[model samples]
Target: MEIEVAIAGGHGKIGLLLGKLLVEQGHTVLGLIRNPDQEDDLHAIGVEPVLCDLEADDDVGEAVAGVDAVVFAAGAGAGSGVERKRTMDLGGAVKLIEAAREKGIGRYVIVSSMGAADPPAEGGDAFGEYLRAKAAADRALVESGLDYTIVRPGMLTDEPPTGRVEIGSRVERAEVPRADVAAVLAAVLVAPNTIGETFELISGETPIGDAVAAL
Candidate 1:
């Protein structure tokens, strides 16, 4: 089933890969980008680039308009301060959810961290701060009343696509390549049963298609 999908933060590392894969699969993709300069790259791959800052209140509603599903793939990268993390991670997700609700978007898929189910211990550093922000956003998504899939992934690596993965609810800490993560996102978009479910993803010997099916 071909669906029109909107990908927030689609200019970033994982987003770029997802845009390409979705396009290759014959799905209509709109790549929502905060950086205007990245628009050209996104357009080169058949993704309609819409300039909208999730932290800002403008152009976001129009960006998701007419789309069938939304993937919240945005994040605050390394070296950024905690405020940016909160705004971009948690606040940004909230804004998107609000906008999606207004737009009547039914399916929402969020990319979250593995240990986000539990709050980090005290004295948690920057990484912990990221996790907390994601956890908060995950909780918000659950309560949003939208069809949602929360993916808690372990360590994100830059390895090539392995075509294999491990997925289960309440799984312990594990690592998965970014390519595999993209595959999972694509699968969740098309899988009806994935809606309203949260799963932990990791790299394993199991085939990617089968792993998602088992989820």
Candidate 2:
């Protein structure tokens, strides 16, 4: 089943990899980017570029107007402070949901962090604030009545893909490669059983495809 998918924060590591995986799997991938410079990057990976800012786009529906599914992969960078975290992480996902409903797109996936569900007490730190934003976004998406899956991966790394993973409600604290994460996202997009589930991901012995199948 081929589908047209829109990826928010299309230039990010995980997002770009996910888009490329989708493209390789014969799915049309539209990457939403705010910078013109990022256009070439997406093109090189076979992902069509759609110019839009999750934070600044007045009508996000226009960006995802024709997509069959939407993946929220946008986030404030490591250097970002607390404000951008809310605007980009929390607010951006919320707006994406609205756009999904307006565009009549039912399939949605969110790339979140492992601790987002039960973040540490607000310690007045940027990381703490990020968790809060993610939790809120996940909550809203689940209650939005959309077919959504929240993938909470443990500490992400730039390591090469191990082609193995562990996926369930909770996984041991471990690092998973960005490539493995992308592979999981691609599978979840096509696997109907993954809908309405929020799972944690980590590196394990099970193959990526098998892990997703067990979802």
Which one wins on lDDT?
2
**lDDT tens digits by residue: candidate 2, 34-116:** 99999999999999999989898777998999888999988988899999989999999999999999999999999999998
Q: Between which residue pairs do clashes occur in model 1? A: none
Candidate 1 structure quality by residue, lDDT tens digits, 38-93 = 98999898999988889876437778998999999998887877787789989889
lDDT of 1: 0.89
For model 2, where is the 10-residue window of minimal lDDT? 115-124
lDDT of 1 at 212: 75
TM-score of 2: 0.98
